[model samples]
Target chain A: AQSVAQPEDQVNVAEGNPLTVKCTYSVSGNPYLFWYVQYPNRGLQFLLKYITGDNLVKGSYGFEAEFNKSQTSFHLKKPSALVSDSALYFCAVRDYYGNNRLAFGKGNQVVVIP
Target chain B: DTAVSQTPKYLVTQMGNDKSIKCEQNLGHDTMYWYKQDSKKFLKIMFSYNNKELIINETVPNRFSPKSPDKAHLNLHINSLELGDSAVYFCASSQVEGGETQYFGPGTRLLVL
Candidate 1:
């Protein structure tokens, strides 16, 4: 079984400041990690993913995440935050050769203060 | 164009009522999935269909059933809905399978009263 954990319930960052949302995972085989964002009543929107090489993976809306193998972590990051970036962020994972189920984290609510 | 879409965006019904939510994907994906997001915003997969064949069925109750008339459409029906059954249902689809990005619908919000 694969699982993802986003330790923070809510993250607060000032506009133009750096933002980070921590994530960790536990899986059997190689991990396929992903990040998704959800606004108000909308469903999850893909942000970025880390499948193989390049520990630093960039994604939509200027968001990025780093895959730290030794730490079993994939933390989402943004160089400079915007008020519009405030949303619920999720970290999901599935074993590379495992079944088709992608386990999701208990989403972190981001509040980008203007 | 909309890659994935779901019908009855908001559903409000009483306990013991039966309701259905319809989902469609125009992305030409062969795999689709159903997920439930509880009040705590924790998402859990309920079922997945690949090319109209059931591929993944989690520990969901038998009262909740998923039907895929075609590869592009997947519908979910619930019988004897309980108060705890109220949650947001999201439909997602991915091309082929494993490790691919899954496009999601706007989600169907169900409220059991």
Candidate 2:
């Protein structure tokens, strides 16, 4: 079965500091990975996705993620964190089975403090 | 205009009652889906429809039935609602079945008394 794993339950970072939220996946074949962020009492918003032909993918809200095929990892990163960046993050993967469904990670809560 | 929209932002009903949550997307996407967010804040896919055809149906109970009148709308109907059914339900739409970004709605909070 294909699945995604977010190792960190929560991450705390200072404003203006680089932040990284780790995520790894397990799939039978090549993976199409995605990252989404959720604000309190709001729906999940798309951040970025890595389909192919690019190790680094940039997305909305000044967010970017690096895809590592060797380690089956797709970690989300931001150059400079802001207090507004504090939210819950989820990593997802679309398996080769072609169900048009995505397997999502448990999710990670990120807190950016001043 | 809202790309995706769901009706009854908040629902509170007694147990064993029936209710329905309606979803509509004006993005003209070909696929729509329903996801449940539990009390622990875990989101899980419940059902999906593509062009009015059932595409993905997860391990959801039969009490939960999804109906898609058209490609742009997918509605969830729950019969004999239970206490465990209290959670926020989100409706989403995508261009295709897989490998595409999904647009989500504001979500509907359902509570079973």
Candidate 3:
């Protein structure tokens, strides 16, 4: 079984400030990790993924995530936050050698203060 | 163009009633999935289909059934809906052989009274 944990319930960042959201995972074999963002009343949009190689994965809308194998963590980051960045963020993981199902973490609500 | 889409953005019904949610993906993907988001915003996978074949079925009650008539469509049917079943249901899809990123559709918010 694969699982993901997002430690924070919400993250508040002022506009133009750096933003970060934490995520951890537990999987049997290698982990295929992904990040998604959901706006209010909209579907989740694919942001980025970490399948193999490239610990620093850059994604849509100036978002980037670092995959740390040793720490069992994949933390999302943005250099500067924008008010439009306020949304729900989710982290997901799946066993590379296991089933196709993805285990998602409880989302983190990001509030970018303007 | 919308890659994935779902019908009936909001569903309000009484308990014990049956309802269906429809999903379609036009990204030429081979896999489709159904996920539920609870009131607390927790998301969980309920069912998945690969090429119109059931692939992943999580620990869910038998009252929920999923049907995939073709590669582009997967519909969910619920029987004897309970209050606990109320949640936002999202449909997603991915090309199993191409990449791992799954595209999602606007969720269907079901409210059971």
> Model 3: per-residue lDDT, tens digit, B56-79?
999999999999999999999999
The lDDT ranking, best first, is 1, 3, 2
Model 3: per-residue Cα lDDT at residue A103: 88
- Kindly list the per-residue Cα lDDT of model 2 for residues B6-97, writing each as its tens digit: 99899999999999999999998999999999987788899989899998899999999999999989999999999999999999999774
TM-scores of all models?
0.98, 0.97, 0.98
- Compared with the true structure, what per-residue lDDT tens digits does model 3 show for residues A60-107? 999999999999999999999999999999999988876678889999
Better of 2 and 3 by lDDT: 3
Q: Give the DockQ (2 decimals) of all models.
A: 0.82, 0.71, 0.68
Report the candidate with higher lDDT, 1 versus 3.
1
lDDT of 1 by residue, B1-113 (tens): 98999999999999999999999999999999999999998899999999999999999999999999999999999999999999999999997557689889999999999
Task: Give the poorly placed runs of model 3, Cα more than 4 Å off.
Answer: B97-99
lDDT of 3 at A101: 86
Docking class of 2: medium
Tens-digit lDDT string for candidate 2 (A1-114) = 789999989999999999999999999888889999999988889999998887999999899999999889999999999999999999999886567788889999999999
RMSD of 2: 1.0
Enumerate residue pairs that collide in model 2. A100-B97
lDDT for B104 (candidate 3) = 95
Native contact fraction, candidates in order: 0.84, 0.60, 0.70
